[model samples]
Target: MICPFCGAAMEKGCIKGQHEMAWLPDDKRDALFTDAHLQEGAVLLASSSIFKGSVVDAWCCRVCEKLVVEY
Candidate 1:
């Protein structure tokens, strides 16, 4: 993929996490949890089980130091 910001060649990769991974709107708070529970309206990217974690396909632009992901 080509980076939309800089027209640079993007690299294919996967985003991984041990526990949970998600994308939230910029207006939302950084806290993903409230009183030990998950907040609403989070776009879950990957979730983990007892044995393994899930991965989401993504493209990274090293030139712009940006990452693009689809859930």
Candidate 2:
């Protein structure tokens, strides 16, 4: 996939590490782990670590420097 904002090509790969502040209240972390999003599974990849589970898929956008979590 390409970044819509910068037109940069997205790299395909799996990152692994622990993500601190993933549960920040203002971040609305719980929304990312909803049943609808995690119906399949969860694979989280943050700037520091990757967390694989049944209800969350979190990751940091390297190009945009944003937190992206898809459950």
Task: Report lDDT per candidate.
Answer: 0.76, 0.43
Most TM-score-accurate candidate? 1
Residue 21 of model 1: what lDDT? 71
Q: Please name the candidate that would achieve the greatest lDDT relative to the true structure.
A: 1
TM-score of 2: 0.30
Predicted candidate 1 versus true structure: per-residue lDDT over 42-63, tens digit per residue:
6778776668776888999999
Per-residue lDDT tens digits of candidate 2, residues 24-46? 33334456545332333433223
Model 2 CA RMSD to the hidden true structure, in angstroms: 8.5
Number of backbone-clashing residue pairs for each candidate, in the order shown: 0, 8
